[model samples]
Target: MIDPVIERPRLTRYARGGGCACKIPPGELEQLVAQVSNRVGPAVDPVAPLLVGLDGGGDDAAVVELDEQRALVTTADFFSPVVDDPYDWGRIAAANALSDVYAMGGRPLTAVNLLGWPRESLPMELAAEVLAGGASVAHSAGCHVAGGHSVDDAEPKYGMSVVGLVDPHRMLRADAAKPGLPLTLTKPLGIGVLNTMHKATGVVFAEAVDTMATLNRDASAAAVATGVRAATDVTGFGLLGHLHKLARASEVTAVIDRSAVPFLDDARAAAEDGHVSGGSRRNLEWVTPHVDFGGTGELDRLLLADAQTSGGLLVVGELPGYPIIGETTGFSGHSIIIR
Candidate 1:
């Protein structure tokens, strides 16, 4: 009654760094980019202007004006498996990559697969399953997964490079958050901890899986419908990490209500049990100097900095169902203030 294939080594074991947490530390990445971000390059007549450049802080994707009315939003995201199920991992990665486009108020147009695999170790059948899962999610978004590239590697990896279209005037920019705007996070935190625990214990968490795989389409639509101009999806950078970048870029201070923030079931308990990831710890350290954690404790801090994969949009204005976690204020030494 047991399938020998399922008895093979768990997928998580092959990964060196799982999910978006695999990204380079935010501090180091900024330092490296600061050195070359201003380099001059050969130029020609431009079809469109760069609306959201990397130098502007933490935009979800790059946008270029395609015409007087529409702009192209482009972003790519991929990582090793965060969960053991190949199909589920594929779905999560696809949703994660698509979030960047949605975060910019764009409708996904097309995506091409990006994969890394150890052909000798993993069967082609399993790879097909992963591709099928990704295709399913992309199809649900009404986006085409036309083609892709693959390479042989030690660890198996998957994701997509997505392109979408947005209105030039209505696109959300990370730098657009103003001093008086309220911050509303559309998803719960602690996904990193939950994932780490799952990786270590092999316990399946249906809720976290469902959360990561769910697209931010509805939330993005809500933000655009409400006329919001500033938004960014919480991904590799935890809430605190991304919020710090947004606040600093906008030259404002973010005041977060410690108790108002939401968390996935047992996320705090997992953190309390020491299930935090190295990436989450790095996020905490990177944000420590900028946050005033009035009465919040270490557990809360870790949860706030928990690295997320396919997280939700942290929009500048309040929406119907999302919780208002914070508000923005004029320049302060601290980028974030927890009360």
Candidate 2:
């Protein structure tokens, strides 16, 4: 008889949704959210002390009035292995966590590691390297590792819970975009396409991979230098999907210029060849109703929902020298310029 052990199916312990950039298809997602809907009106939360939890649209976990004058902002982010290198994986995960603080106009002060690993499959040395990678970024952000939690799973996972401080007045919210606010994206899109390709065939654009692995330290600092009103990091949902959330929460609509947006050159071809990740396609369908395209190329439209991991900051406001590639208005759906 043939050996059943050798014929057993291979087990993989990871998910397509890496980190904050989960790919929920636009069309079906809308239906699901509609079925389990909330009472539409003003947000009235029972918890009063929590100034910015889910209600205020701030990234991570943000609390206020713990002290009379200072508000405490915190966030946690983690993901399964996106790359083979343990160090790079840890670095990207930590960067993703720190980004939430920067998005809320805060600086990170502390972090606790979150780790999951397959004890028998992967080596503890590799996990240590991943933590080292994460620690490097956290150290650079002026954050020290306070502590963390770890679990043994079938795959390797790592991230951090970052604690930060934001002034009550200067805290930025995702739903604070004003009509005519300029939409400017910091890092180029296409990480989702490239990474998906990597997973399927082990191919990737070095630039996109590097950007994904790199932290938001410099970009966030540059944005803060420019003084942005509202911002959010681009992750699982792709650029337009997250933008749609900002618009919906703020009761506005977004208009993007397909041409002006920056993207990795080769990514479009990959997306055109139908190399898109599951998350990317889901993102496209989710924003279909509210998203209007003015004769944009097929690839261009697909690029809008290209899921990302540890992607750049999408900033909306009137920051000089930052060209207005898109706009948000008090309308019900999305619009764009053809030419």
Candidate 3:
């Protein structure tokens, strides 16, 4: 438990960008990847065939076929603080990192911490709290927190590198979406705007924090059990951005029912009050060309594209307890249509 006597430092202040919002913009990242892929050329019959890597719209993790029944999934993710509380920030970051494995319909086996801290500015005790938080969550997920690496840096950062296992035949892919399938979202939107508001005003939004910290384990299990093949977590890119990626990769167009989409209670209020993050705005701008926002206001559009941290899985098929936000259709010149 955090001590009541000692005043906690605002960790977000140390970060130039919070959470996954710190990620390189998707548009720019694609260009860099294209150039690198061109030079690397194609692998010619490797020992273990690569099931998924930096291809097919950049799936959640790199999955390599281990055998007929199993494949190995590996992914690494880290980001600066998103909340003022170090422990909560740690939990949120861990969940976000583990989410990559879950998004690909895999179960986490183990994780190693990746930490960057400024020794001169913050006490080592605070870092311990963060690590403790991560360990606690990983334990709950039944994943081992074996060990990790740390570095001294100007700004503090924390996350993990995770390894998981999945059945090669049952694994999910972003490019597996087919026309006529419903889109199911496991969590609500507006986390980015709420987080932006929290950073600016220091008002705690417990719901948003909980949302980010919540694991996608159950959702992933449901998708795989239901035989849903296409899925991706709603993170840095936001819903519209990720949907566009899935649609483009699957050679289909996603039609989102703006009204059916869910959002946190205060998400709209925060956006209306101009509490949106630059990353969210940038996400909107990046996917604007491919998105047909019919009769949707700018504010609604911004909310839809709000950059998320450890958001939720956007599955390509319906789930019993989740909301069906939209459906996929044959390619119609546009990657996403919001009505």
**Top candidate (TM-score):** 3
**Best to worst by lDDT, what's the order?**
3, 1, 2
Ranking by TM-score, best first? 3, 1, 2
User: Which residue pairs in candidate 1 collide?
Assistant: none
Each model's lDDT:
0.90, 0.71, 0.93
**Candidate 1 lDDT, tens digit per residue, 67-124?**
8899999999989999888899999999999999999999999999999998998888
Compose the digit string of candidate 2's lDDT tens values, residues 1-339. Answer: 112455421111244445444434555655665554454543477333666755533343565645555678888888776655567778888888888887777788899999988788666887888899899888977899889999997666788888888766666677767777778787888877776665555453678657876766665566666666677778877887778777776767777777777887678777767778767777777767667766776677778878888887778775444445677766754533223
lDDT, residue 292, model 3: 93
The lowest-lDDT stretch of 10 consecutive residues in candidate 1 is: 1-10
Comparison by TM-score, 2 against 3, better one: 3
RMSD of each: 2.0, 5.3, 2.0
Q: What TM-score, computed on C-alpha atoms, does each candidate reach?
A: 0.96, 0.83, 0.97
**How far is 268's C-alpha from truth in model 3 (Å)?**
0.6
Tell me how far the alpha carbon of residue 97 in candidate 3 is from the true structure, in angstroms, after superposition.
Answer: 0.5
Candidate 3 CA-lDDT value: 0.93
Name the candidate that leads on lDDT.
3
